[model samples]
Target: MRIAAITRDRPPHTKHTAEVVNANTVVSISFFAAFCPVSSRRFPAIGFERHSDEAKNKGNDFVAWNSLISSFASIGNASGAKNAFDAMPGWTIVSWNALLDAYARKGQQLRRMESLLDAMPEWNVVSWTIMLKAFTKEGQIDSAVAVFDSMQERSLISWTIFLQAYAARSGHLAQARNVFERMPQHDAVSCNVMLVAFAQAADPASAKRVFDSMRQWTDVSWISLLAAFARNGNLEGAKNTFDTSPFRNLLLSTAMLQAFAQSGHIDQAQAFFESMPEWDLVAWNTLLTAFAQAGDLYSALPVFRKMPVKDIVSWTSLLRACSRDPAAASIVFHSMPQRDIVAWTSILEIYSQAGELGAARSTFDRMPELDTICWTAMIFACSRSSAGEQALELYALMQMEGWNPNGVTCLNVLAACAHLGLVDRCQGFLGSMILDHGLSPGIEHISCAIDLLGRMGRLEQAEELLRAMPFSPDAAAIRALLSSSRTHRDVDRARRRARSSCSSLATIPLLSNAML
Candidate 1:
């Protein structure tokens, strides 16, 4: 019963059981004794006891001794395994190998593992493999290579692990290719790793070269090349790779579908999606997201209704898809089996974005909880709908409710004051952004305050404020100045020309080959 209890591997519960386990007593010895009625050779991997020294002197329990050593080693207790080894009256090659394995697996002690390996009386392919993996785990690349060169024999797995170390390192592509060219044995995994490495580096031409040289291609080969082309924005090359591949699985199809969607080839994205022999929920969601991004709810709405399973992600995609249409968003909201905070938040944003302030307020009132983002979104919604005063009121209520405003929330409050041309409130919010919230006002926040000054016909104060900014004044601040100049119609043409030139330089993109 004690042997069964130990072998079951449940957590220690009672005091008696904990004492039995801690003592490492006859419970471990009994594990080997719990054999089948027919044969001791068929003993289960439970605990065991060492018999009298007389039995050890007689050499009758060699098999049981070796099994106990291996079992403890397998459990990662190096000290216990070593103690079991010291208890052995004789040793075999298997005992040495087991002890080596235990030492190798002891975490992050590479120097100790190397010393242990040096102490082994004899070594085999298994010993070399263990050493290779230990070195690989520590990222000791030079030591791994030295071990690889000294090996009298190498298996396919060993060779592949050696090559992968090079492929996994940055700026070591030449080394990886050199090793691949010299491989005496070629297998699919090793070949695919090189291909995938180049693909991950966004080198589609090099990847294709490797692909063409393969004696045969796996589905992984096809997927790697497809992903490489997609990442490089070679849509035509991606399609060609897809069409010529011998097989098409869901993963490859999804890769192509996403590539087309990101490149604004919505028509091709839809086509690839429909061509898949099987459609998982991810595929459906991807299609919905593509259509939604194109703002073509005419296609997305029908698909959402036909899905056999609708998780929160599916509904959220549809809600975000139909953001331009509050009525459609509301219909999806009412149909949810249950809604989480994200769902409630999305509906609130949809109503807010469409300028339905009363509808937004009703939804906000129904919310079971509120966070800073919810408060900010409502504030932004009010300003967008020309209710600047109401937006300010909500900001006050948010503060009273013990919700400290974040950078975005503070910025939205400033924008509301700007819309209403409330100069005092604008200055107060800008100061509060720095001192109260510990957030330095970014250029956009200052731009908003300057707009408030411009709208109030304080052109000179706005100009003075722009000159006082710690960083270079951006185009928005200059445009604020221009707007005030238009209000006055007294600024010189040369001043307007100078401001326009600054805006032009800031707007034009500086590309990599600008000197050319």
Candidate 2:
């Protein structure tokens, strides 16, 4: 059937046109169906399916069925490919390979791939590699190694696959090197892949060893090694590698700047910035992040204003830095080109910190959507600003709207209850933590509860609750009780309880060391 199609193009025979060709060879048939033009009257899809069915009727010849399955797989219809595999009367090596390839694309079909492999009458190198690659991609490295062990002929491809798999997992760096050493033929790619793996694992020593061992090093190898040094917080090593290089590349330089910024060497980072022959957006952002980390929001402002372009991270970093300084917080907040939840939350925190709950509430009310962090930020802001009533209201609304409170949220809400003298409401909030959220109360939550009880003159119950807790009382809890007692003039009782709390705390080094 393929011959007829080839012959027709060479010599125009009256009987040898595409019209006369039988759709018996499904491989050619499915391929033609995918690319061939359709008449206006006939639906292209229906014609394609009809040709596909004719191709399938060829009794699962490895050549024909492989092509048919590939046609369906190319269109991202895995179920259709599965159906085509099922209809095959019998299978050959090519046919099984095609089916396995289809199943590997859909990660959810690992069981199906395994079942097909188990039922196969014989195995080949291609079959084993397919299974190994599937397991490696799914992060099942142990299973991939097991398949490699079972292979009778170990090829370089097989060795490289396992090496790449270990490198990708990061935790298996030693095993990745073992495979690289054992490979009989070391190609450029094999060395490069190992270098990348070591780089990602933050082992510059191993990466440098691979770099030195390579007979030929490409631009890719240099970038990979430089990136490793950057990620491992080795800016000096990265700079040394960059300086000795015959070729200068922007990516390598950018990696060095990023490393310096991340490690908190702002002066060194600025020096690198000035050393750059030219600056790009990435370099600018690196400098911006350095200033943010240093808590020098004033220095970050000029960089933010001068950037040729800005992304979400740029805006968020500046906003967060501004949040720490109340005077500039609102200015930066209003000047943002685009605001994400992080930007909005930073502003909310600023207002909360400055004791302007009205502005903080206004910001919260204006937010387009409230994520968990946003809710937590707003709750904390109000709690600290002495607007506990507003904080409680927001907490109730959060629950009614189906937003689950996390540990931070629970701590903030408990603090609000303590600050507002909401004694009865505190018990209900505690019940909700156990019943609805199923979160165990941590020291922060317990401390807030103790403070609430002590402030309301329920000293006996608070002491009992403190004793009943699995963990001993924390410094904050003891201090809250003492403060409440001193205010109420219960000096005798306060002194004894204080002594007992201090004695209990001595068993833990951190608690005992902390000055109250």
Q: Rate the local accuracy (lDDT) of all candidates.
A: 0.72, 0.73
What's every prediction's RMSD, in angstroms?
A: 13.9, 12.4
Instruction: State the lDDT of candidate 1 residue by residue for 119-193, as single tens digits.
Output: 554555555666666666668798778777877777666677788888888878889988888889777778888
lDDT of 2 at 363: 91
* Best-performing candidate as measured by lDDT: 2
| Model 1 accuracy (lDDT, Cα) | 0.72
Off by over 4 Å in 1: 1-249, 399-407, 434-443, 467-475, 493-516
- Clashing residue pairs, backbone N/CA/C < 3 A, model 2: 26-55
lDDT of 2 by residue, 1-516 (tens): 111211121222243111221223432332233223334213334555775667767654445566667656545456777787777665655556566756765565677776776555455565666676677878887777777777776656667777778877756878888888888888667898888887787788889998999899876688778878877888788878777777677766777787778777888888988898888887888899889877788889888899988887888778767656866778777877888877888788778777777788789899988888888888888888877887888888898888999999998998888888888888778878989899888877887888889889988777776787779777777777676666566666576676686664532342222223
Clashing pairs in 1: 28-47, 28-48, 29-48, 29-49, 30-48, 31-46, 31-47, 31-48
Ten-residue region with minimum lDDT total, candidate 1: 15-24
